[model samples]
Target: MRMSLDLQHLGREEEALQVAEAALTDPWVRHGDRLALQRRVLRLGKPPRRWRRPPWAASAQAEPREVVVSATMIKGAAGFKSCFVVPPARNGSGGGGGGGGGATGVPRTACVEELALLHYGSPAGGGWRGVHSEGGVWTTLWALLCWDVLFMDVPEVFRSPFQTAPLDLDTDAFLPARREAVDARLQLIASGGAPDLIRAVWSRRVGTWCRGVNWERLTLDDLLQIAGCVGGLGLSVVCRLLCEDAGGWRGGMPDLLLWRPERGDAMVSEVKGPRDRLSDQQRAWLAALSAAGVRAEVLRVVEAPPPPPLPPPPRPCAECRPAEDGGTQQGTVTTSARSCTAGGKARRRRGAHVCGRRAMAVPIVCEGTEGVTGGCTTDGTGEGAVVAAASVAVEAHSGMEDDRVVINDDDDDGSGGGGEEDQQQLQ
Candidate 1:
């Protein structure tokens, strides 16, 4: 199972799928391992062993809760990788791991979080300092605020001093055993004494090992800042939720913790890229946070449509003062309709010039076959005549190096004048 998860983390989806699928069938795989393997297989786009739910359980269908979903469009810049935004592999390698190691072995610096940090932490985005820990920060705050309640010598819950968390921490028994102490801590947190409790704990046990406290990423000041923004009621609500089912509730906490000290505002945002959807756990967390009066939401990052192509650079009008050479410089004739005066009459046309008495001719070099040489002339001063002459020159020169169209003021139709001088000027 670890091997499969590691492979998935390394972006090797096929091998991860194979390992997870194989692990599901292993007789040695326990119930917990089986569940994990099944989830992995499903994430890899494979159908796992289908075990039917009990009849009673099957009949119970609950309405889905509404979560606040705010959508924002962001340009899909190059380095932004997200399972939702980026196309997944055929085998489905979508996986994510938070700051504190959990079931999903996704890296802490996953592209989704990086993008969130990039956007939300920038000055243009309210300049909120963001922590990318999915639930590690919340867990740490809970642990710090309830340090004494968790470590209270309950029978069977704390069998060894070496254990980071209580024996029944992941089980339902831990809460029941420590309900009294848990309630006391909750009351204290609700009464706005969370910061004091956290400071006391940090002062006493700064370097001590604890279950969910990430000393490396979080500091004393960081915890205080969080406590300040996530006031008594908000922290109390979140702590109670974690206390009820720390194992399950901690898994789907929002991906970002954004707070502005100056404004004293904080919010948790779960970023969803193009095709991402809220998981059942995430929905529950969002609903719970909203109910508790904490700002929690699903930030849907949409891919902004490509910017409209830039208009071609402005070119000199056909009627613009001609160059001193009296010959049109080598440039492609654009298909733009413009109004120009030709001999005291205004004419609007496409790729047609009205250069008055100056009479300028634009030459086109058509490269064709290698050896044969030739030249040609065409009537009319429109660009069509120029194109027609170039085509004729290409057809005549089977393997020629250069073939061109020449125009002079005397010959308004651009006919004849195909010789060494025209060829030299064309060259």
Candidate 2:
């Protein structure tokens, strides 16, 4: 039985299946021989019971709970896979292991946190800085979401804000004002202030939270869902600003500018309302803006909501192997010693597997203050010994070619502070 299991683990599924199936055909077996053998060998049985929906499923008020459940389930699956496949090691014991040493040693969480820092930190120079305003929050949210999706990182901090115990808006006037202040700060940064405000917020909120979270546990779809939430907020603001019915500018607020800095112009004017019901004055303003390089237009926010949830991901395909005769085959199969020899020929005919290809090598040149001091070839196979030897040879040759090379002015200063004595020794 152990031998058969080993064969299955080695991807010889067909051989294991044959061994198990053959055992059931033995004449010594009783009336339930086949079923008993299958139970013992393959562990075949009825599937487990399906999960029951929570009681809140029937109420429209339960939507938030449902969304939480959906997001949790999706992210949980990824987290489970990450933990199971790449469990944290005990100190540095596993550090020196070679290939196929359980799992790759890459630190998934650290990579994600670095990516998030880069995304938020890049916009710190010239543009906006001040207290957060509604508009500024929306802008930052949109940019963060877009960069998050484009770069493919956890974006979990954004989702974390929504999951925190729901805010009591009525009791907490400061909560709304806090969001507004955040927006105003972003506006100041956008207008011209340094990114210090953004850096401060990230250090206080995002950086602190991310330090403890393992980002590798989050999936691509989880990040996308967060982005969708941010995008929805942006869409809400855009709709409100474009559809307002007040004709003349009663407030000191400047006309809404649908600016597209990427395109070097304003794309549209949103007078918040019905497209066909635009007043004559509003229409004239839109026409004038359009002619003057601003593409002005208004769009109404419809009352209809979006569609239902998407289906869960499909299950992985069953493991299988090809027959020795070059014929298609299904199910896990273990090859017999005779069949193994035949399969070798068949594999050769099919061409070398992708994993066999040697990666190309590239030469890297190291430059110092003195000049291009050395060069080394890095073979894509990741053999550090070879790289080190090449690097040493290059350095040795470079040093021999120019024995008097002075790489830095700091090297001239001796710790003893005897500058004249050092100079005399060099001469």
Best by TM-score: 1
Give per-residue CA lDDT, model 2, range 1-427, as digits (tens): 4555677789876676557657666753322223334443433212232144323223211111000000001123533321111113211112110101232444333221112122112232111111112133323332232222212222222334433211221122322334444354435534433233333443454522221132233233332332232233333333222222111211112123222222233233232211124443344344433433333444332222335799985432222223454433322121111111111100101111111222222222122122212321232221221222211111111112221221111342222121221111100
User: How many angstroms is residue 371 displaced in model 1 relative to the true structure, after the best TM-score fit?
Assistant: 57
* Best candidate, lDDT: 1
Tens digits of per-residue lDDT, candidate 1, 12-97, equal 88888878777766764532344455555655753343344323231122222323222334445677554223221111122222
Model 1: ten consecutive residues of lowest lDDT: 339-348
As a whole number from 0 to 100, the lDDT of residue 2 in candidate 2 is: 53
Candidates in order, TM-scores: namely 0.52, 0.16
